[model samples]
Target: MESNYHTLKRNYNQLIVITHLTQLLTYITGFGGLVVPLIIWATQKDRVEEMDAHGKSILNFQLSILIYSIISIPLILVFGLGIITLILIAILAFVMPIVNAIKASNGELPSYPLSLNFVS
Candidate 1:
C-alpha cells in the first residue's frame, strides 16, 4: 500500500507564523532570515496549509530587500541618500515580518509591501 503522507494537508498556523517571524533572524544573527524561512517553506509547503503562499511572500520580500540594499550602497556616495534608504529598508524588514506573522495566526494570507515577485 502507498503511504498517504503526500496527500495530507495539515493546518499549521503556528508554523506559518514561525516562518514569518524567522525573517527577524537576520536582525538577530546577521543571517538566516531568508535561509530559515526558505528551508521551512521547502520542507513543509506541501504538508502545511498556506505554507507555499507564505513562503513565497517571505522569499520575495527578502530578495527585494537585498536588491534595495545593494542599490542603496551606491547612493551613499551621492549625498548620503543611501543611508536614509537603508534605514527605511531596515525598518520595513523588521516590521513586515511581525505584521505578517500576526496575519498568519489569524488564518489570513501574508502581504509584504514592496516585495517583488521572484518566486511566482
Candidate 2:
C-alpha cells in the first residue's frame, strides 16, 4: 500500500510539471497553449488534487495572456505599440512556462503575475 501511494504521489508531481510545461505546445499548435493544459486538467483533476490546482493556475495564466493579447490588437493604431505588446507577450509565453515548470518540479506552486482567475 505504501508503494502504491508513493507511485501515486510521483505521478501527481509529474502531472504538475506537465501542467505547466505543456503550455509550450502553443508555439506549435497556435492554440495548444490553452487546449493542452485544459485537456490534461479536465481529465486528471478529479484523480489528483495537485493536478486540479496546478491545472487551474496554468489555465488561468493562459487565459489572462489571451485576454491581454486581444486587448493589444487595437494598440496597433497607436504608434505601433501593438507590435511591442505582441512581442512581449510572445516572450512571456515562452519564458513563463519554463519558469513555472521548474517550480512545479521543485514541488512548489507557481503563480503567474497578471494572471486572472478565469478558471477558478
Name the top TM-score candidate. Answer: 2
lDDT of each prediction vs. the true structure? 0.91, 0.88
In candidate 1, what are the lDDT values of residues 41-67, reduced to their tens digit? Answer: 999989887899999999999999999
Reference-based TM-score, model 1: 0.90
lDDT of 2 by residue, 17-117 (tens): 88888899999989998998999999998998578888888988999999999988999887689989999999998999999899988888887888998
Candidate 1: give its CA RMSD in angstroms: 4.3
RMSD list, candidates in order: 4.3, 1.2
Q: Note the residue pairs that clash in candidate 1.
A: none
Q: Which residue pairs clash in candidate 2?
A: none
Model 1 residue 67 CA deviation in Å: 0.5
Worst 10 residues of 2 by lDDT: 48-57
The best candidate in terms of lDDT: 1
